[model samples]
Target: MFTRADLGKDERLDLMEFTLVLEHLGLSWTRAETQDRFEKADANLDGFISYAEYRAILEAQGWV
Candidate 1:
Protein backbone atom coordinates (compact mmCIF):
# COMPACT_ATOMS: atom_id res chain seq x y z
CA MET A 1 0.00 0.00 0.00
CA PHE A 2 2.76 2.45 0.86
CA THR A 3 4.68 1.39 -2.19
CA ARG A 4 1.68 2.20 -4.37
CA ALA A 5 1.43 5.69 -2.95
CA ASP A 6 5.11 6.40 -3.33
CA LEU A 7 4.86 8.28 -6.56
CA GLY A 8 8.37 9.66 -6.22
CA LYS A 9 9.76 6.15 -5.64
CA ASP A 10 12.12 7.63 -3.05
CA GLU A 11 11.05 5.09 -0.41
CA ARG A 12 9.18 7.83 1.39
CA LEU A 13 5.83 9.52 1.10
CA ASP A 14 5.05 13.22 0.83
CA LEU A 15 1.78 14.77 2.02
CA MET A 16 0.06 14.26 -1.31
CA GLU A 17 1.10 10.64 -1.54
CA PHE A 18 -0.02 9.98 1.99
CA THR A 19 -3.34 11.54 1.22
CA LEU A 20 -3.72 9.18 -1.67
CA VAL A 21 -3.01 6.24 0.59
CA LEU A 22 -5.80 7.35 2.89
CA GLU A 23 -8.11 7.71 -0.06
CA HIS A 24 -7.13 4.30 -1.32
CA LEU A 25 -8.05 2.90 2.04
CA GLY A 26 -11.50 4.44 1.65
CA LEU A 27 -10.71 7.01 4.30
CA SER A 28 -11.81 10.59 3.95
CA TRP A 29 -9.78 12.83 6.16
CA THR A 30 -10.01 16.60 6.32
CA ARG A 31 -6.82 18.47 5.53
CA ALA A 32 -6.13 19.06 9.19
CA GLU A 33 -6.73 15.42 10.03
CA THR A 34 -4.39 14.34 7.30
CA GLN A 35 -1.71 16.76 8.45
CA ASP A 36 -2.06 15.61 12.03
CA ARG A 37 -1.71 11.95 11.06
CA PHE A 38 1.23 12.75 8.83
CA GLU A 39 2.96 14.66 11.59
CA LYS A 40 2.56 11.75 13.96
CA ALA A 41 3.74 9.20 11.42
CA ASP A 42 6.72 11.36 10.49
CA ALA A 43 8.53 10.62 13.72
CA ASN A 44 11.49 12.78 12.74
CA LEU A 45 9.33 15.55 11.30
CA ASP A 46 11.54 15.53 8.23
CA GLY A 47 8.58 16.26 5.93
CA PHE A 48 8.36 12.69 4.66
CA ILE A 49 7.32 9.28 5.98
CA SER A 50 9.90 6.60 5.55
CA TYR A 51 8.91 2.93 5.16
CA ALA A 52 9.86 2.29 8.75
CA GLU A 53 7.74 5.20 9.90
CA TYR A 54 4.87 4.06 7.77
CA ARG A 55 4.98 0.52 9.07
CA ALA A 56 5.37 1.76 12.60
CA ILE A 57 2.27 3.88 12.36
CA LEU A 58 0.32 1.04 10.85
CA GLU A 59 1.41 -1.30 13.59
CA ALA A 60 0.64 1.28 16.22
CA GLN A 61 -2.79 1.80 14.76
CA GLY A 62 -3.36 -1.97 14.75
CA TRP A 63 -3.88 -1.79 11.02
CA VAL A 64 -1.11 -4.21 10.16
Candidate 2:
Protein backbone atom coordinates (compact mmCIF):
# COMPACT_ATOMS: atom_id res chain seq x y z
CA MET A 1 0.00 0.00 0.00
CA PHE A 2 2.70 2.45 0.97
CA THR A 3 4.82 1.59 -2.03
CA ARG A 4 1.93 2.01 -4.41
CA ALA A 5 0.76 5.23 -2.84
CA ASP A 6 4.22 6.76 -2.85
CA LEU A 7 3.82 7.76 -6.45
CA GLY A 8 6.69 10.19 -6.33
CA LYS A 9 8.89 7.42 -4.96
CA ASP A 10 10.12 9.86 -2.39
CA GLU A 11 9.39 7.60 0.57
CA ARG A 12 6.49 9.73 1.61
CA LEU A 13 2.92 10.43 0.64
CA ASP A 14 1.79 13.91 -0.19
CA LEU A 15 -1.91 14.80 -0.29
CA MET A 16 -2.25 13.55 -3.83
CA GLU A 17 -0.65 10.25 -3.00
CA PHE A 18 -2.72 9.98 0.11
CA THR A 19 -5.87 10.23 -1.95
CA LEU A 20 -4.68 7.40 -4.08
CA VAL A 21 -4.06 5.44 -0.92
CA LEU A 22 -7.67 5.92 0.04
CA GLU A 23 -8.76 4.72 -3.34
CA HIS A 24 -6.52 1.69 -3.15
CA LEU A 25 -8.35 0.77 0.02
CA GLY A 26 -11.74 1.02 -1.70
CA LEU A 27 -12.59 4.31 -0.10
CA SER A 28 -14.33 7.16 -1.87
CA TRP A 29 -14.33 10.51 -0.15
CA THR A 30 -14.79 14.16 -0.91
CA ARG A 31 -11.77 16.46 -0.96
CA ALA A 32 -12.55 17.66 2.53
CA GLU A 33 -12.86 14.17 3.90
CA THR A 34 -9.71 13.05 2.15
CA GLN A 35 -7.73 15.98 3.45
CA ASP A 36 -9.04 15.41 6.94
CA ARG A 37 -7.95 11.80 6.88
CA PHE A 38 -4.56 12.69 5.47
CA GLU A 39 -3.98 15.26 8.18
CA LYS A 40 -4.88 12.75 10.83
CA ALA A 41 -2.50 10.22 9.37
CA ASP A 42 0.40 12.62 9.24
CA ALA A 43 1.29 12.10 12.86
CA ASN A 44 4.47 14.14 12.78
CA LEU A 45 2.87 16.97 10.87
CA ASP A 46 5.66 16.95 8.34
CA GLY A 47 3.33 17.65 5.43
CA PHE A 48 3.92 14.13 4.25
CA ILE A 49 3.03 10.64 5.33
CA SER A 50 5.91 8.31 5.93
CA TYR A 51 5.53 4.56 5.95
CA ALA A 52 5.17 4.58 9.69
CA GLU A 53 2.49 7.21 9.51
CA TYR A 54 0.70 5.28 6.81
CA ARG A 55 0.80 2.09 8.85
CA ALA A 56 -0.41 3.92 11.92
CA ILE A 57 -3.39 5.27 9.99
CA LEU A 58 -4.19 1.91 8.46
CA GLU A 59 -4.27 0.31 11.89
CA ALA A 60 -6.07 3.20 13.50
CA GLN A 61 -8.76 3.25 10.81
CA GLY A 62 -8.95 -0.54 10.68
CA TRP A 63 -7.81 -0.52 7.07
CA VAL A 64 -5.02 -2.94 7.91
Winning model by TM-score:
1
TM-scores for all predictions: 0.94, 0.89
Please provide, for model 2 over 1-64, each residue's C-alpha lDDT reduced to its tens digit, 9 standing for 90 to 100. 7898788999999999989878887889999999998898888999999999888887887767
Q: Name every residue pair that clashes in candidate 1.
A: none
TM-score between model 2 and native: 0.89
Per-candidate RMSD, Å: 0.7, 1.0
Per-residue lDDT for 61 in model 2?
76
C-alpha local distance difference test of each model: 0.94, 0.88
- Badly placed stretches (over 4 Å) of model 2 are none
lDDT of 1 by residue, 1-64 (tens): 9999999999999999999999998999899999999998999989999999999978887998
Worst 10 residues of 2 by lDDT: 55-64
Once superposed on the true structure, which residue ranges of model 1 sit more than 4 Å away at CA?
none
Candidate 1's displacement at residue 56, Å, is 1.1
Pairs that clash in candidate 2: none
